[model samples]
Target: MTVSSETRGLAVVTGASTGIGAATARELAGRGYHVLAGVRRDRDADAIRGPGLEPVILDITHPDHIEALAARVHEDSQGRPVRVLVNNAAVQANLPIEVFAIEEWRRMFEVNLFGQIAVTQALLPALIRSKGRVVNISSVGGRVAMATYGPYAATKFALEAVSDSLRRELAPFGVEVVVVQPGAVRTEMLGRAIAAAGDLPAMTSEQGQRYSGLVRAINNQAVSSTNAGLPAEAAAKVIARAVTARRPRTRYSVGREAALVHVVRFLPDRMLDRILAAALRPHSAVTT
Candidate 1:
């Protein structure tokens, strides 16, 4: 369609404080949709508030915050129909499965998986009324879980599955569910994950010795890949297309790495393993 504010309805984007989510909110607004950009902090709210963008305090994990967001959508004074819900709030940690505490794993799922579901459930009525779409921001990790990316990848994998089921279930209602898998992008999350991975206090001495080099390798690969990755605005454009396209694809890959993962996923497990290991080997310089 037409990219006109008079015709476009409201779009809700979670995790809009920075990176892909922030860029997406801006993009949708620029395309003439009134965007309710979700942010956790007042400063971020202030930062993203302008033009067609309205910042909403939404911590998707908190029921109250989600309820408030749903209420806001239902009670729009302008009577704008809900057009899209972009589930972009997520957390990343690069520790190995054995390194993370049970609580940490649960927290990751809480934010990445359950939080998205809760928000979707709360807003389903509005979406159904408008026959809108759901855009989930997954990652290449969703299809290919690398060393030290277990917890975060697990959540994305589950989200991919959920999107599949939701898509089929919502088809009869005219609601579309689309998954966007993005590879390395220039985002603050990469630096945060690298910093978090360097925390070896969670590992035993022997465990640290065994995995520290792997962690460092992963960090190095992350940095190099992200340095060569697309800008957040590029991914935002894809998401905006997913939002506005008349016949959107079920899944959209944002970067070259993501497209490569799509092709490689069909390879034999052993072959994929060798490829992934070889890719990481170049960065595996042991450091004390």
Candidate 2:
């Protein structure tokens, strides 16, 4: 953790109420950086109690909250510079493409894509002043698609591209953009995905019948996958490395599953497609 005397302001982590965000906040604080922990509600803010951490209520999808966060970061610094910004807030939609609601897609993008852009833009000034780092939390889905996760993967793919472009764009300013992709982390996101898949519209409804099989397959997969996921603490270790390392890597893929997914990305497309198809195929045979 090296910092010049004039530019040791703080690190701001969005989605800081729980899971990876909360873990990252604790990790950064342990590394000796003051942390601006952003949460969606007062209860979330209250939940994150730790040394070197100050909670801020910020809904990334809201312009006013974004502005308020920027103002607060600037005000707290008092001419000092923010050293790190972690854009970690995101949602995963686990519905079939055939049945997925467009509004859900919109919601994911609002927070995962546009909201990230908004917050990064807001924090750039302070980051530039400190020659800071931007660590974006993407997913292995960005590299490889999975069934029933098209909507979520789309956002992660967009985020990965944005991180790449920003890395190039921000280099001259002495700012760094790093993307961290974690695979199947044990988090509440998995629970939500599982629940959503089980509670679908009636089979007679438009798009519902088409996705019944897909939904059931996804629910089963999610249940088993939950046990296979890495701990949030393990992924947080990589975030800490990205934040504190002297020469942080441009990208980090944490956990065994994430690493394997990256390897899958390099495989022949048809072969990978076959593997994915089999993996997602339903266990129960169609009886009709």
Candidate 3:
């Protein structure tokens, strides 16, 4: 468990296939840390080509993958402590909560929440030994819920809650926990959610018909706004800084919009709720 003061230890980052995760892995490497990038596909592993970066095929939802990663990290570190852990993998669901299939909701939680916990638990020893930090890649949705993104936001909200508790519990152990909330980072996530909606049973159900127009408008608005959002690398840099900071913050919002969302957290519940409703409201809606 003893790491030389001069040598930077290993950093584990999940969901390093693309977007924030991939960029974070690269950023950490540039900051003089050995990075184990958790990617889920062969193509993703192939894509992350670098000197200090090593790609591990990791599907966080799978126990086998989690166990294998724990062993791999142990072997790779050679008793050296793990310096950082970033839980950045997530799935998205865009639909009215009333019509969102329970199965799909569960899947989102499995990947975004449960899997994240599993990985963290598996690596807890290494993190504790090194007194390293845990950086969770949450979203602005975690603080402010929006319609049509209920399921996705729900998972993040729960994640933020759990992360808060975990931070308190681990503080005594010298293991800091941090949450990085990004607002509409320029990534394929929004587009992928829209593209996958076509085939979801919830999107084809009767309730879907009733709420289809409202949901479509919300999704489109979200996509259109991405053009003005921060690039994934911006979040990556923030996360990398979190990993190496002498005294890292409990939470960091990476973009202008994310900063706004964080500030709005101080607003009264009624004020915030009204603002979110107005933002998610369809452009053409009947009003009294």
Candidate 4:
């Protein structure tokens, strides 16, 4: 027998094509919520569509998509209240701060920060009406901006700030805003970031010389960390908890690395710098 969303309510998860987003969609659906999983491609839509899970084509940066998503939520046949909105869509690239062109910086922010805000804005009415939660997927980078992670971290850092402000603003209205910070997770995002980094214009010789080893080290470290990191299911569980907890924390760290990052962020700046440098040194050895 199929369960009805009238009893459990609804969940909307963006970037449901892969990784943490996909897992969260399935997790919510399994837990009996009717989930609208947002993906960008027809194939991804087909892949994620099933009982208790409906896939919607959404590109968060597009106003029409955002508008349509809001309409879908408002016009649900079952009239199930939206229980949670998971703003999980994002893009990543590993490049030195100087190597990232202004356009690249804007593009990352478009997807990572602004896109999230747009979705949240569009759904806020329904969320407020249902007293629903907003779950923003940030990162450890939000707390500590690592070398060669400038653009991505900048967006996440901004998101952390936004989540703080939103949480405070929504508290009185019964709606909650929660931020989930995940460290390295086994996801295709690592491979995509590596490929995207390779696709950028060739670095100037001077710029390359200054950053080549650091970039390589960051990439190497990312690969190693992701290989050892928790699977997407772990993150999904944390997100689900944030959605369901009667007294959810304002922020939840998905992995031990993320938990450690929270503590490490309190260290003196120079001390933190030295620790970060030391962590990367083994991977930074330049090869002829």
lDDT of 4 by residue, 127-187 (tens): 9998999999999999999888999999999999999999999999999999999998898
> Which ten residues in a row are the worst by lDDT in model 3?
279-288
- Candidate 2 lDDT over 58-164, as tens digits, reads 89999999999899878875565688999999877587776676776888899899999999999998898889999999988888877778998999999999999
What is candidate 3's lDDT per residue for 166-225, written digit by digit as tens? 999999999999999998789888877876666686445677668877876787677767
Clashes in model 2: which pairs? none
Model 3 stretches with alpha carbons more than 4 Å out: 1-6, 77-79, 202-209, 281-288
Clash count, one per candidate: 0, 0, 0, 0
RMSD of 2: 3.1
Compared with the true structure, all predictions reach lDDT values of 0.92, 0.83, 0.85, 0.91
Candidate 1, residue 3: Cα displacement in angstroms equals 3.8
Give residue 282's lDDT in candidate 2 (0 to 100).
59
| Regions more than 4 Å wrong, model 4 | 1-4, 286-288
Candidate 3 lDDT score relative to the true structure: 0.85
What TM-score would candidate 3 get against the native?
0.91
Worst ten-residue run, lDDT, model 4? 279-288
